[model samples]
Target: MRTNILLASLVVLGFACQPTKQKEETASTPEKIAVPVLTKAWETDTVLLTSESVIYDEFRDVLYVSNINAVPPTAKDDDGFISIISTDGEILELNWVNEISAPKGMGIIDSSLFVTNIDEVVEIDIPSGVIVGRYPINGAKFLNDISISSGNEVFISDTGTNTIHVLNNGDVRSWLNDSSLVGPNGLLHQGSHLMVASYGGNEFSRIDINTKMRETITDSIPGGDGIVSYGDHYFVSNWNGEVHFVDTAGNRTLVLDTKTKGQNAADICYIPEKKLLLVPTFFGKSIVAYEVK
Candidate 1:
């Protein structure tokens, strides 16, 4: 009789809590995914010769282009330089910072602009456009893209050696040298995750910052050169003059292509406020902007 009474009381309690639990479940449900589109807005003139990457500064309404005028990207002959252009497609100052050797990709922390030059992270003061310092990785080879986390942790990809190096303040060291990196070229650092675009291996991977767990996002971007986040989608660029849009589910859509023209979309940058994508055409010698619709 006591067991029966207790079971009845438990059933009543469960029923009493049902509505609240349902309400909590509904509140925790994820929102409907967003599908974004893109349209070519306006492209800058073909003035950035051998430009490998583009990064935008909204406060100054300027874009920085990393140009490797040298033939081979691995060359450390100091011919590489950076170009500054206005957002309105005007050349503010060509060869803006001319002290690096093969500056490929760039990131910024506060007023400092950091670029990967050969095997070092070269820091340049944004306002003065002066080369501040260079933090060399002890054994990095062909350092490619750079991405900075919200905490100011700098992560650089070494495409030549299949490694990822980390820089905190002035210290530099190889953080992840896993085979899963597979020629990491373009890096996008989010709050809790790090996304890698493997150009040589032609794959997209995401690594958890805390757990270090890796997952393959996709393998559609052949010659994957650049990656930028947009809403719930990711914009990817191929060195062969193609840009693709990929969703979290691994679905891909070809948004732009200039392969027939022999133009290379090396590294891309996105300005979220203006909904514009800046694409640095390596061989095309141009910085093109596209509108995200």
Candidate 2:
């Protein structure tokens, strides 16, 4: 997650309006997509210090939250930790694994949990809660998010350097570093494409895994932090505490906003089976659950 200090100048861009509005129809107008309604289901206590990212483990039926317990997000304090929480918004273990330094995004492949630290990816054995592997990326400034493919390939985003690094087989290398990847933060692997949410600008792009072709789906949401797919639509969050719904036609609608309340929406996770959207408030120190309907 981008620190509030770095994004202090960026004003909140949330609409703070109704979500179920339809545009006037015209002969050449693309079909308007229906935006889902978000209802607050539950919110955790304000105890998760600087919660940056949250991921759901289907097998364990729990949630993992990354806490950057440092002043500056890039600080190598070695005090960062991962918390395990229940689906009902109860934090089970505040420091389930505390050996990481400034841990951010997380992904799991089999029984191994891969999380990005300042400049390296740390793997933990979930079953045993032991540190298993550490893959350091040279020249990596700030590693942010992790997305694992079906083939067990790990993809990580470095926000400070504007690059995406991959861990294939046993080697960690820079995968894509393009001008369009402005502060790439959130990554989601979709079949043959990787959906990227850039923080530096209003850019939501799709990259082909095989050909490395880049396609811009939309460029209207700023401070993009986390992304989740909802059929052909998508739910994207901004670090400034707003969530927007993006349709297949690139139309965006404001679905939720908490900036006015001084809450920060960091990296988010979605559970399709439960139709729940989990938002980790960075400074608010809590996870808010919203029912997607």
Off by more than 4 A, model 2:
1-31
lDDT tens digits, residues 1-293, model 1? 99999999999999999999999878865555555666777777787769999998767788889999877988888988999988867888888899787999999888999999988899999999899999988788889999999989899999988899999999987878887666889999988899999987789888998888888888878788899998867998988999888887877888888889877889999999888988888988888888888
TM-score of each: 0.87, 0.88
Candidate 1, which ten residues in sequence have the lowest lDDT sum?
Answer: 28-37
TM-score of candidate 1 versus the correct structure, residues matched by position: 0.87
Scored by lDDT, the top model is: 2
Candidate 2 clashes between residue pairs 3 or more apart in a chain or in different chains? none
lDDT of each candidate versus the true structure: 0.87, 0.89
For each of the candidates, give the backbone clash count: 0, 0
Per-residue lDDT of 199 in model 2: 95
lDDT for model 2, on a 0 to 1 scale?
0.89
For all predictions, the C-alpha RMSD in Å is: 6.1, 16.8
